[model samples]
Target: MDSKTPYKANLIKQQKVCERNFHKLMKLLPDLENNDNLVLSFYLAGWEGQARFQVLERAPYTTVLHVNLDAAWGQWLKLPEFRIRIYRDVRMAEIISVNKDRHFKAIYPYPNEKMLMPDEKEQLNQLFSEWLNFCLTHGLNN
Candidate 1:
């Protein structure tokens, strides 16, 4: 792995959780292949309130595919938030840059006081399904 990879450490920390979520989502989407066409990466960021999940294309910096999840919103929605907001923001911005630029700033919305509820697992799976479908449809992976 590249030493300068931005989210290497974060990805390592959340590998199991992210993989579990990804596998569940993949099972739901029969059309998506787990091989070359699709790639998945996950990371955790320490925003003021709590840690958030960041998902991005597992390609080099030249590829312009990425996403960022808002921990605050995830907490609010009781879902495992992972970069949906960032994806939407980038679509709105129409910036054609690769994933090299950190286009977002951290902010504290609320402290993470609640425990990891059981339902969050299902919610995370659902969210990942939506994201995977989006990626497959847009040809972002292949």
Candidate 2:
């Protein structure tokens, strides 16, 4: 057996977790067929992944809320290191970034009192739910 086999296998597992969580987050966004202001961009590569949900405004850099989730793994690690960044401005004037080492119990837009795994459904759901609400209340128009 190749020595790299186990590492590759672990990476596959982490990639699936990232993909599944990415889809869960995507479901919470308003449908793309009906809304042009909101866009989702996702990319995954073996043990690493990145997903972004962006709310655009009338003018570029005028207004935007960008939520990004990134995951990666070190050798021999089963779970990837996950990080979440919430950016409230087009120019990224206001930003919050959290890593997996932190406990995640509450949702974002609120104090994340605890840390959470990147793939945890409940936290992902709450995060996206609040994001959608924020977009709507702030005039996403779609």
Candidate 3:
């Protein structure tokens, strides 16, 4: 085995990330529970962009949200899209999918099906965290 952080799940970090994500999501969409979708325009000097958050499913204590970043990201035409699952009771949110790829494992075999990294889930949640931080810090409904 490679000498690394042993393959243990980082529950503490994941939980923290989830909680922060939930908080930022609520900040971006204060009417999330009452409304089905939220649209925000981001304007900074010469650049202007938009972000859309739509609730795909809603339950008593759970909600699935689809976030679309509507902007030109260099050469990529599709940009980035995220589907997040929110747990209202726990005040947590996690990335269910990114750009439509849903499967994530805490650890994966070296020669697995998709060449996924060992810590795919952790990486995904971290990416979500960074994205949310960027949106909250630089853009939004404020």
Candidate achieving higher lDDT, 2 or 3: 3
Error of 3 at 112 (Å): 2.7
Query: For residues 1-142, what per-residue lDDT tens digits would candidate 2 score against the true structure?
Result: 3434321123344334434434433455546324534433332343443344454433432333345543354335442222333222311222222333444432232223443333344444345445434434332222
For residues 27-79, could you state the per-residue lDDT of candidate 1 as single tens digits? 43334322323333323243222322223343322222234433444655653
lDDT of each: 0.34, 0.37, 0.83
State the lDDT at 8 in candidate 2. 19
Model 3 segments more than 4 A misplaced:
1-6, 74-78
**Candidate 2 segments whose C-alpha is farther than 4 A from its true place:** 1-9, 32-53, 56-65, 68-142
Ranking by TM-score: 3, 2, 1
Query: Measured by TM-score, how close is model 3 to the native structure?
Result: 0.87
Locate the minimum summed-lDDT window of 10 residues in model 1: 89-98
Q: Give lDDT: candidate 2, residue 123.
A: 43
- For residues 24-48, write the lDDT of model 3, one tens digit per residue: 8888788998988788777666666
